[model samples]
Target chain A: MKKLSFAALAGLLATPSAAFAQEAGGIDQAVNEVFAAVTGPFVNLIFAPLPGTSFPWIVLWLVVAASIFTLYFGFIQFRAFKHAIQLVKGDYSDPKDAGEVSHFQALATALSGTVGLGNIAGVAVAVGIGGPGATFWMILAGLLGMASKFTECTLGVKYRNEYPDGTVSGGPMYYISKGFIERKVPGGKIMAILFSIFCILGALGGGNMFQANQAHAQISGILGDYPGWITGVIFAGVVFAVIVGGIKSIARVTEKVVPFMGVLYVVAALVIIAANYQQIGWAFGQIFEGAFTGLGIAGGFVGALIQGFKRAAFSNEAGVGSAAIAHSAVRTKEPITEGFVSLLEPFIDTVVICTMTALVITISGQLMVDPATGNYLMDGNMIQTVGGTSGVALTSAAFASAFSWFPYVLAIAVVLFAFSTMISWSYYGLKAWTYLFGESKRAELTFKVVFCVFVVIGAAASLGPVIDFSDAAIFAMAVVNIAALYVLMPIVKKELNSYLSRLKSGEIKRFKG
Target chain B: MTTSIVVGLDGDGSGMRALDFAKKLAKGMGTCELILVYVIEWSPYSFQTAEENAVRHKRREEEIEAALERVVTPSVAALKKEGFSARGIVRHGDVADLLNTVAVEEGADQIVVARSSEGGFVKRVFGTATANLVMHATVPVTVVG
Candidate 1:
């Protein structure tokens, strides 16, 4: 089994990745190589041609998306921030809102979509590679991603499709494809179709499979001696049972789980951090220094910054089109309501949660063990695990150093965090599947089955290589999503300005359903 | 083919009301195998797993037994200490579907739950768990106000 995974990884990599890594051997070098294979060349061969060529070009496209939307919608993220709060406070819970969930429900749903392994495992990767510096960039990217989320979710509400049955379906796929068709863009139909295809694939890889795999890994780590496939089969069965029932089940679970787990993990991380109160100053010093000083195992300032940004971008997933699908299902007359609540996701995931992960690891004093200082030999260096394991266990070790009970507590936290995340992603991927493949029971079942299989794959295999590749796919979704949002920025801007006007006029009146 | 009536108990919001009503309904059903369920909202803070983060897969089964004893037994006992044949099931994810799943598992005829809604107008138009369940459930769900 190990041989097959390595071989499959080799075949996947021999195509483009291994050689690229040879050319660039910094900490992120291996990660970048895997990403290179996924973003354009490999995916294009399997599917269709992607729009951009270079990394900078990809960044440019996203900037264009933010700019066009900001100008067109008159900077909705800023204007709507205030009203978004009122909306979150329950100002617009009208059943006539043409969606299956309330605004808070939608925001919680979307948050469940974005806040997952990325925060925990993803942050671990950044800090492991970038040292403490990655936390800074991760926080910055999370804040900016808020605006992108605001723009995309606002678009989700405006362009949402209300079926005669009160079942609503919307996302980047709907807004980009359906909205473009209404506007009559040249080859807009093809663009929309292509975007839908990418979304479904992205959903399968990043949202569904990735979630199951990470959750399985966390569970296996905590329980010990369990069959990976058994976890997969049982998880699939449970997810199948929930998903087969559709969005209501998904909403019910996420609303409760997201808040509870989110608070739980944060408080636990804080507990560990607080115990090391004397080291707090040094921890920040190391993080800021590592950000610019190349203080990690990567051996360069730029490398640490890039890894941090990449992981943060991957973690919070603010710019990606995934959150839009979750937010799109919200029940609100106003699009901005869901968008405002959506802003909290990045703060929770990247700024707060991601920071906690970094601090716990850093404060645990396992990061940069200067054998010279004889302090503890970590130094942001990627220590190779003899057997395949990463993420929560590593965070666990850090906490255990400060608090004896942390190992067990952290393990339990990881499993639940991973479980809730995987279930939520299953919903996102299913929606994407339904969007592109036609809503058939077979399509849904097949996707669910494959997703379950991948969970086992994620658990059994070493996380580093495959997750590196999968992380790229998650970012690739951003490339496509930002492009669509750029073109549809006007719709987002218009929604923003209108909401601001309403807020200024005191029209929102009261808050609560 | 034992006739079973399953009632979902949530400790939060209007769940207390749901449990009380389900107990009354069970009494009326007479021969029904009453099943009481309580979902612990995911909290990093818990007395049971106080120092722990998640309910272990095995422990969840244990939690089902224990919660049945602790929360349900006393509550059920209060209904004139009904000496009815009853069991409990505990699930880990979302409340609405878990209740729906338990209903299907126990072959429940009716599901009773309390409505949790945030906004006033939205609550009326949507009616919380009742509205959501009606849209998605394969069985009739009677939500306690």
Candidate 2:
């Protein structure tokens, strides 16, 4: 009976793509059918259009939450930006502090998860659709998003459950339930459950599958069309090896890979931007002009605003709360210091990395502008669209214009980014899963195996709608997480004020000047 | 006269070599107590968020337990089996600093550690704990290769 059930499960999993692989069209159609059936209504509901406009309410939800946090914290993102850098530098870190990873390692781990294809492909899509003006909004959204990261991460560490074995289980579930109960809020437990459910789903979809899918896309773009399952199997194996060892192994890998890949990508972008130094002014002008004036696109200013805000929110993921999980594992008694360090994440990701990508794409002359209307031409006539562009391909074309060898470098970067993101998500998902199922070896293994399998499915299958649903699931996490954040902000404020006062009084000594 | 000798162990082959040397030295010294300490190189100065920091004590305890169980205890037992007086402890901190601290705290007459194979650029750039202890330790440090 066990064998029969296993075989049946195998067949069920394989039928969608494997059975129809002989006929690519049939497989794509079937995938689309199932995808549309499952994700269509769900996506519509989450990204429901704003009144009399095509802008997604979810995007507005994130924007407003970020704006509110910025105001409530008195723009702490800007005020504490310098201090955040110092925190990351370990200037005030005491060696006797109790923690697993350092603040820098925690930030690196979180940044790896956030700084993947979203910065590359997501930015390209935003720029392609919203024009250069989208970059301005993306930067603005990133700036505002820092405060959200600060609030959520602070609370994450404040209420985390440290096990007897010295391992930590934390994130929105712990914070929402614990923080709310402390404040005598009624729905804390239910909110925690809801957040956990969404977190697990988001981890599998956005964190695992989406990364696998994009890595496969980039590989095929370079290595010719081979089955995605091949990529999937390889990815699953590597991810399993790293994640099975738990956070230490994952942290060690991410701390190295994240920084290396980040620097490599940034240096390359800087080189391209510097080479086009003359056009730097022109690019900034186009960005500013398009940001407010909208380049006469169909949605105009609102459309650009939506795209820019959406990409930035998606890229930095301030209020989404996944970062809190990664940051919570930092070894510090003062949780507020982590909050300060986390604010740097969005800055480095969107403000620095994403901006570099935008500049490269803008200055590469890949985006064609109609001189008469002073608007971008989107009829697929630009050099970036040679192979029918949008997303990572467009970004690749932009870079390749400066260096012919850039496509190969980009392929490597994409794979490393995908690998780092998948492992980090595995931890996030496992924490949420354990929260619901009760933490045990069996439960952890179950989640890890299931996560690895999805990595394969993500690579092999052409389920666009499934990925869309997963993306929506990620935003759904933001909804629940931000609600909890609102209630928990007061606690965060108390911590922040106490920490700042301590700093002023020299109570928090600098171990290193 | 019970002479106390501090021996550092890293749970590696080199550490065992040092342990063997210390055991021989303690035997030659007639009546002696071998204070075996395994120091796990840990930096508390790294920046950590609250969650990782919360479990710091727990992890340190676990590290001490593992070091005692997997490394120090077995060695101490074997030494005792050989009719030598020995005790084991595990700690988390800089190896040289902790070794010196443990030596002084135990009131040991001398300290012994294996010469790490790590040399050349690594030794110059990031000096080994043995070299540091030899220079800075209050007690006499015996470098056993």
Candidate 3:
């Protein structure tokens, strides 16, 4: 059996390029065609362009939910921002809490999951298409997304099932199913099943494949072209080792690597930004102008708004319900405390880190813009580029303009970011898998093996439609998650009010200042 | 007639050496009990995010479990097998401070510790836990190398 399987694998590897030569179209194209044919309709439905515009309703769904959460909680993201910092600092934490991990580890793990290629490549894409004005909308979206993060994470902790072994199982699935029962709402079980299915798909696509694909891109871009299967196998092996050990192992690596990579990326941006201190005011001016007047792009204000909101939603994943799974594992008796801590995830991931990327790209002057018509120029071409010329290449070019050797560093950061993200998403996917298939050892092993296999497929295949389907699956989670949040916001409010009152009354003891 | 001696276990070979010395010393002192203390140095002051803090509880539990399974229980059981009265404890905090506190709380006549070989720059710069224990312990301290 082993010899046969090995022979089959060897044949598969050896034939890919030869097959490409013979077919003229290649395996990537064939796979993409098949994926598009099979999954394109559902992807289109989820990401259908709004009437009279290119923007998807899913973006609007996230934006609307975030805005409602921000208002419904009375702008708790702003009001509790200081306390959120303190909560992360463990000022109100007791070491005796019933959860598996600490608030800081949970936040770090979640941040590692969200703050990957999106912050680096996605920001560049948004700015390239939507212009400098997109930065303003992106920042606004990040601010509002914090409230959404707070709502979902609090529900994650409140409704989580703590097993006898002290491990926790939570997320939108738990909250949607259990929270509905508590509130006497209907069809929670069905919604939870739907959410679980989407979450698993999202974990495989965005969390696993997207990361592996991008990491391969960055690595190959630096090391010169090699078969992507090589990168896929190596990444899959490393990810399997870390993820198989469970959240603890993933957390250990992320806690260290996430901070290091975040600092490295931010400091590089800061150095470049500082070097262009003279252009700082001018950049902000462009951002404000482009945001309002549409920078002469066809979409104008609405276009910038859509790009900004879409990228921010995609980057920080505030309303997508993925981070809630990571945060739900935090050791806290008061579920509200985790909510306070989670609000900082979007702020750190989007507001702070992504904004830095945008500023660096803008200040570097890599993106050629025509002053008269407010259009980006590529060889005197009025480029109506959306996802084109955006991504790691753009970000790398922007950084390379400032520091010649920065592309190398950016490549390293991308790989690390991709790795940490994959590990975190592995846990997220596993939790959803267990939620569907009972939490047995065999079930867990099967899901993990499949997840690792997807890593290889992601790296090996040029799967545009697969990526689109996965991205759609990720946003699909937001649809169901936001619906549940709308129903459960009142419960979060009650927890918030009670926690605040007790906190104000000194009922919540401060363990350390 | 009863006396208690605090033995600080570092969960290493040297810690077993100190435990042997404490057992021998307790045998000389009539009706004495050896209090085996394993200190897991934990600082709550580091700047950490909520995600790091979430795992702190599990880590602390794991640390205690490891100390008991790999350090305290084995040492205590070995001494008890040799016919000495011994009890074990695992704690988290500043190693020296916690050791001193345990000595004072248990009414230990003296504190025994293995002399750590982590000297040179670390010793001159930060000072070893054994040195700090000897200097700050309320009761008399014996360093067994």
Off by over 4 Å in 2: A1-12, A15-20, A23-31, A244-255, A296-298, A371-374, A380-388, B1-60, B69-114, B119-145
Per-model TM against the reference:
0.65, 0.84, 0.87
Worst 10 residues of 1 chain A by lDDT: A93-102
> Any runs in candidate 3 off by more than 4 Å, and if so which?
A1-26, A95-100, A245-255, A369-389, B1-6, B20-35, B40-66, B74-86, B92-112, B117-144
Model 1: per-residue Cα lDDT at residue B9: 69
Query: lDDT per residue, candidate 3, A361-457, as tens digits?
Result: 8888866777786556542222333223566788888888788898898888889888888877878888889999998889989999988888987
**Comparing 2 and 3 on DockQ, the stronger one:** 3
- Candidate ranking (TM-score, best to worst): 3, 2, 1
Please identify which of the two predictions, 1 or 3, would achieve the higher lDDT against the true structure.
Answer: 3
By DockQ, who's the top model here?
Answer: 3
lDDT of 1 by residue, A1-513 (tens): 435443453443233434433432342344444445545454443323235421233434444454554555455556556666666655554422211244555655556656666677777777776677778776766666677777777787677666653456677777877777666665555655666665655655565556666666667666776544466557666655555544445435544655777787788889878888999998988778777776534546765766676666667777777777777765566776777777766666777888888898888766645656423234335633212235666676676676777666655555556656666666666666777787777987877766665565454334444454455555566776776776776665566667767867978555344
DockQ of 3: 0.24
DockQ of each: 0.03, 0.23, 0.24
Q: Which sections of candidate 1 miss by over 4 Å?
A: A1-82, A92-100, A245-258, A296-299, A369-390, A440-446, A449-472, A511-513, B1-145
The candidate that achieves the highest TM-score relative to the unseen native structure: 3
